[model samples]
Target: MRRLPIRPFAVLATVGTLVLTGCGTETGDPGDRPSSAGADRTIRAHKVMQLTQTHEETGMTLLEGPVFDEDGRLLVVDVTAPEGKPKVMRVNVSDKTFRAVRTQGQAAYTSAQFSPYDGRLYLTDFAHGEIVSLAPDGSDPRTFFSGEIDGARMNPDDLAFDRKGNLYVSDSRGLREGEARGRVVRIGRDGRTVTVLAKNLAAPNGISFDEDYQGLWFSELTENRVSYLRLDGEGRVTSSHTAIRVDGGIAQTDSIAVDANGNLYQGLHGRPAMAVFNRNGERLATVELRGRTEGLESATNVAITPGGTKAYMTVSGPGGGFLYTFDALAKGIRQSNGG
Candidate 1:
């Protein structure tokens, strides 16, 4: 998914300023703004499992899309794995064991989540621009959504489903092209109606419904900010605005999750950390890796348990692919499950 070179932290500071001023309408009053000077609390995450080790020829492992299943097992995808290798795996966090979930074809899977309606596992194939599904045990592979929509090719990065079983996806084309070619699409439970909810976004990567399901929160990677779209009863975008403007330094916003309290857990790329933000776009705390971050730099996606007891992040780089665990800030409901 990261086809572009990593930008320096200095460069990002300039970019962040431009994005904050030009992106969208800002919510919350200036007087209510929480100080961005630093996080109130800092939590250290420990490694729970290492999926891959450092390799020379094969390159650094890039892991993404950490989601929990109904049985409480963690599911993740390795976007850099070659063909014949296990692209998806089920990790039993209790014992630190894992099982490979067979996926057909050479698609580079980026995200995974179990549908609350059908109880099937769905994944976004970043390489093929397709959304595929399978059983919990990783059987019955089938394509759910694919190809172009309204003449635009999809570069699906992350996805989430609503309580009504409607699926939403972030088509991340802008990050690679450096333009506003990104889009957010919604598919009805019938699996036939595909609706384009929002367009002209700057590489929208992560997506999740708000606590009340009245709107959606998505991250724009190129813009270095997170935006929200107020939705109608029909799941159409009524209005939208920028919620959080992040100074990622060397990192860019990737996947995100919303807790029961409507707090957003925004994952970062090129930095081993997850930035927590409240509904008013205030910084709460930052969860970071405990030890050296020499090679493990990509902390792209995170998922919290149903009751918000624990949270896990998928990190990968030259060091290898690993899952890091920490405590959750709020109760993790359906909105924080996959995205």
Candidate 2:
């Protein structure tokens, strides 16, 4: 049940395809993008699954942080080269038409996620510092959370939603770049707030819930580790433990995601590609990746393609940001399906 991005208005009603982009790109194709000493075509790419040239930024980059709605439309909040309150745009996956999503938020948006349950969009304003929801028909905006919790600091950078409609936000807790104290707040319908479901954690960048709601998984950026906490009846932490620790020793792990089969995909902050971990916390795969060198170099956001097809990631750009798609199998990709 995917809805078109067009309202029943008199004009501008068009259809588009869903796309995923990332990487601070180099001015060449994947084959020309990067190569190791003996690396050649053996590092083949699967159909170049998808490509984005941010012409807006001199054809050297694609905006980072791409997400999708049900209609298969790709939405990304470009932090660089922002113009007049319009920072987010929808890129037609099948085609290459760009439409604006939000032009003004009074703050720079770090990341966002679409609510499939309601077709509403939620975004984090890292600069002005808040979480907001965009109107369904692309209308007004509303505030969900701000850096103020009971008059305390709660600046949010990332967001995640659970199966039952509970909202999870990754509150960096402070403004310092890599602060260790962070919290994941679950906002219940009753407006009640809950924490870490455990506490004294590291910089939890991305937060996700297991399909069964039995537990929650989150990753620490500076710590380069992912942890899982069994949730109690009220979504509080019952038992928490590390699911995967960056083996390369002290690499920064940014964004994280889980797939249909229950495997984890984690983006290493300083690595050339992303890493895969089994639900059992075993090392799985390292997704090969590279960009135009003109855009983003880091993959900070990750999503599982709808229908279990591809893996979507967002790499912030040199100026605009881009989204890149990967062939999970062809790339020797392993999903977080507990395998």
Best by TM-score: 1
Candidate achieving the largest lDDT: 1
* Model 2 segments more than 4 A misplaced: 1-65, 80-85, 175-178, 190-196, 248-250, 290-296, 329-339
lDDT of each residue in 227-303, candidate 1, tens digit only:
99999988999999988899877678888888888888888776777777888987877777776666666777778
TM-score of every candidate: 0.87, 0.74
Report the C-alpha lDDT of model 2 over 1-339, residue by residue, as the tens digit.
Answer: 121111000011012211221221111122331122222221111222333434332223323355666666667765432345346777675664577777653454656676645557777665455667786445778876654654556556566666555667666554254446667777763335645464455656666666556787787665667888788777777788887777644346666666765656666554335665667776555565543333235556555556654555665433334456664422211122111
| Each prediction's whole-model lDDT (CA) | 0.73, 0.52
Local error of candidate 1 at residue 209 (angstroms):
0.5
Lowest lDDT 10-residue stretch of candidate 2? 5-14
Clash totals in order: 0, 44
